[model samples]
Target: MRKAVSVLLAILLAVTGCAGPAERQDLAHVSYLTSFNTFGRDAYVYVAQEKGFFASRGIDVEITPGTGSVDVLKLVAAGRADFGVADFTATAITLAKERLPVTTIAAIHQKSLAAIVTLEGSGISKPADMVGRKIGDQPGSTNQVMFPVYAKAAGIDAGKVEFVPSAPPALPQLLAAGQVDGIGQFVVGTPLIEAAAKGRKAVVLPYGDLVPDLYGNALVVSKEFQGKAPDKVRSFTDALLEGLEYAITHPDEVGPILKKYQPTQDATVASAEVALMAPYVRPSGYSGRVGGMTEERVEKIIRTLVEARAIPDGVVLRPGDLATFG
Candidate 1:
């Protein structure tokens, strides 16, 4: 009788596909950092949390907003966060070269959205025209850090242009009010700029057009975290990839999810921001896989950074050294 009852319990556990009590208690706790606040730009992370994907994978993810891409990398490297989203160019060229001990696990934006924006009637119609213009941007903004590379590729002397630093929220307003000739902003910020412009039209010169093969944001993990918790890293990245795929297919459904996290975010604007970011999230000429990086792309970025003097020429980085895939 005892043997029969034990056999019955084992069969029931197998049929139900349940884990043992010990397995149930071993969920991994992960801390994730975003490059910026909870906006439409961070739709994937919001969706992942709202939909229970992270929980389903046994990862308790704590997502935090960041000041900027560089800050995200710093936080992860310093062990404040287990993983983070940051600009690939900055990570590869600046942070990696400085030996910050962070490795990119996935490339999120296959193409860069960084741009130089001006009013439609402004004389800065082309990249060459930006040589003598005064551009306003927040200190250490992505555009400011990358503008030299864009200028070098466009054959413009970066030294000729003057950069006026302002608070981030005031940058678009400075351009709209004619306090500055142009602003350095992301193409995804078009809606915000339009809203700030009130009625004026804006002209955007995308950096991708000038600098070929320029990459964008990526998911990064500190070397310590990667070594200490390889399985947890894989689970977190897989869940994020799933979230990104879902958000891409259900663009109409992400705004409300994002609004849940950022109450002040406009649903319509959030949806528009997601749409603007769609192409960059998975560019047509991409390597035909989600979150995949190639040696060619990394090499081009390093070469461009060298030409722009963003890093010393002697600095060398290999793709395998800075990236990993599971």
Candidate 2:
């Protein structure tokens, strides 16, 4: 009887010892929130998840679609998500001024993709032509948020332009139906807009062309996460950059991967959007580095936000406070 009890104890000890290391090796759980629903612009995250980049770094990432950039920052700041991608120029800077404990870790878009789109024969050929024209706008969109800066830069009175608020999904349809003369949208959405136009060519006036050197979306992490798991933060950034580079180099491969993850997404449109975003992701004369931000570039973005009165004049932000590539 004593031998039987000893044998059982020995087996239990062996089983526990064998299971411990395996359990410890399980991937850490992490969540990433995107500024909007899964679109071609979110190729990096989709590719990273599909290609096992996050898993290779010992992270099991759960990607959630956001309603807008502000929502993404709010979610990350509240500790609801470990990381998020949002508009670094307007949304992140504004939130940072409000004393939210969030900082951008990497600049994903070296140039802004936000644009004012019009179809051919709309007679809205230029920014100034938008005056007195009803433009379709989605509340809280990056284009709408930064339109004031564009208007000021172009010497146009924003007050004269009637912005017809509509849901993002409804904007294109409304424009095609002649409800609005133009629409504020992203360059990546050009394909969708053209498709909606049903043979009418869409004209794009990219914000990057208007506001030179203005940065766009970025990967942001909560201050609490950065304080506690700095290594994880770094690891996540590195993996994401790898994914970005991969997507950039293999644009054709990205669409299928994205569609695999999101079956409802149009494959042709997704592919075209990826192609459109490549230049913004790695702009002309870029330093050939993924996820790099310069202090001057960041300051320019914050200054634009202030000049547009999007944030309070008293709000102060330094480059270090807004972002840290390391």
Candidate 3:
């Protein structure tokens, strides 16, 4: 009887092993978080969620609303959340301070969507003409900081332009009211929609256009979590790659997807956003695949942040700071 019982226990263990992680009692429970506004590339999470991609991959993804990208990273690093998406600026600053050892696993957009936008009717046809104009923007967001960086590239004096801090919602009001001349926008978010809807013609100043290189948003994991759950990590990325392919091939379908979650997103604007984001979505490649990061590209972004004083000296980390699956 003793031998028989022992044999049965061994069989059960083997069954558990074959069942894989999903059937395990202590399966990894993933909690994902992202800021509310920066939801273009990030919204692919919803695509995976709604289309059953995460379920297919054995990931239990729970999303939490974020106040902003910078805050989202802080929560993830604190172990309050599993993972989050954020721009390179926030991660680099924290990494420079060595405050949190978060590593960026995958870069979603090869180039930054950060842009300088103005109406065509403003008579601000070129980047240089931005001087002395009233620019509607949040006081200390990425725009306020990077505004000068791009302005100088266009030979425009950054200080000459006046910045009026406006909430994302208020931007349209300010522009329509003719209170502010122009506002900066990401290719995915409010600015693009407003441009298309209200005939808010904008001169898009892609960060890549000026710098020929930039690092923007990415999926980041805590150093500790990444070390422990390499398999789950890979699974998460594989699923996102699948969703990205869907988005690229079915741009028409994305508007419906966006409308489902954010019903406020105009289908017309959403369609335009889908078009704008195609280059970043990588029709064939994704964060899980290779060529996502080049050696020179990493160096260029790191060096720019360092020069901007966004990072400080003494931390040994560089652009290759994260674990690369491909």
CA lDDT, every prediction?
A: 0.81, 0.82, 0.66
Error of 3 at 233 (Å): 2.2
Angstrom error at residue 59, model 2 = 0.8
User: How do the residues 203-312 of candidate 1 rate in per-residue lDDT, one tens digit apiece?
Assistant: 99999887758777789999998998888898999899788877876778888998888787776767777788888888776556777777776777777777778776
On the 0 to 100 scale, the lDDT of residue 126 in model 3 is: 76
Q: Quantify how close model 1 is to the true structure by its C-alpha RMSD in Å.
A: 5.8
Residue runs of model 2 more than 4 Å from their true location after superposition? 1-25, 307-310
lDDT of 3 by residue, 1-326 (tens): 99999999999998877776546434456988764353454566677777878778778787765544456677788888888776655466655665675777776666666766666677777777777788887654556656655665666778898888787656656766678887766766654536544765556656557765665667777878888988898788777657766775676777678678877766556656656777764633445352155656677777776665455565555666743434
Span of 10 residues, lowest total lDDT, candidate 3: 283-292
- Of the two candidates 1 and 2, the one with more favorable lDDT, higher being better, is 2
List candidate 3 segments past 4 Å from native: 1-28, 35-41, 65-67, 156-162, 189-192, 195-197, 283-291, 307-317, 322-326
- Stretches of candidate 1 exceeding 4 Å from the true structure: 1-27, 285-287
Local error of candidate 3 at 3, Å? 42
User: What is candidate 2's lDDT per residue for 1-326, written digit by digit as tens?
Assistant: 99999999999999999896776469788899876677777867889888888888888788888666777777888999999988777664457466778888888888888889989999988898999899887667677777877888888998898888887777778889889999988888888888888989998988778788788788889889999998899888889989988887887888899889888877778778878888888888887578888877777777776776766667676777888754
Between candidates 1 and 3, the TM-score winner: 1
TM-score per prediction, in order, is 0.86, 0.88, 0.77
